[model samples]
Target: MYLTSKVVIEKEKIKKPRGLQNTLHDDYVKCKEECRKIEEREITEKYIQYLKTELEAAELVVAQESAALQATSIVSSNNQNENKLDQVPSEDSILKSEKETFVQEENLIV
Candidate 1:
């Protein structure tokens, strides 16, 4: 009904139907442009986008969006923390990795 064709009473009246059809047709056509411009308020792109955003915020995965935002902030904060520290791997971590690698090599050679 939204994008459907407008009333074509004028065109129908061309054939000149009688009785109720004729009377209703004349009645409808009498209005100022016959309600063709009934919906005068233009639907703006901004309003439509706002409506869509509101609908998504209300009905869609709001929690998922919040979780994603929190995860992103946490990741960014972690990166910032790492940058602030500006340090290489600690001795224990490096030693642990080296030991793991050596164990793997020994297993391969055996």
Candidate 2:
């Protein structure tokens, strides 16, 4: 009876790998590889996001410099305009002053 039981147990163990469960191990390995690929993809996406953020920050810095340059140009133009206005004389006052000088010189000569 003990020998018969041992034979039966070995026969049952032999039947464990029939059709359906044979590929289960292969499928598990494939699934593990797929999970690893997914992890790599997520890491690449995060790196792309970091680069995009850095690009946006660099663009903002360029915009700020452009604005500063524009402001400086405007201030310089305004100063030049003010200086030009100070140097320019009214037309009527210049003619009247010239006429008085001519009359005074003529009277002195006479």
TM-score for each of the candidates: 0.27, 0.54
What are the per-model numbers of colliding residue pairs?
0, 0
* Steric clash pairs (candidate 2): none
Question: Who wins the lDDT comparison?
Answer: 2
For all candidates in order, the CA lDDT equals 0.76, 0.91
Residue-wise lDDT of candidate 1 within 1-110, one digit each (tens)? Answer: 53333446545546644545567676777675545555443346567888999998876687888889999999999999988789787999899999999999999999
Q: What's the distance in Å from true for residue 69, model 2?
A: 0.8
Residue 18, model 1: Cα distance from true site in angstroms: 69
Candidate 2 deviant stretches above 4 angstroms: 1-24, 86-110
Candidate 1 ranges beyond 4 A from true positions: 1-78, 81-86
Residue pairs with backbone overlap in model 1: none
User: How many clashing pairs in candidate 2?
Assistant: 0
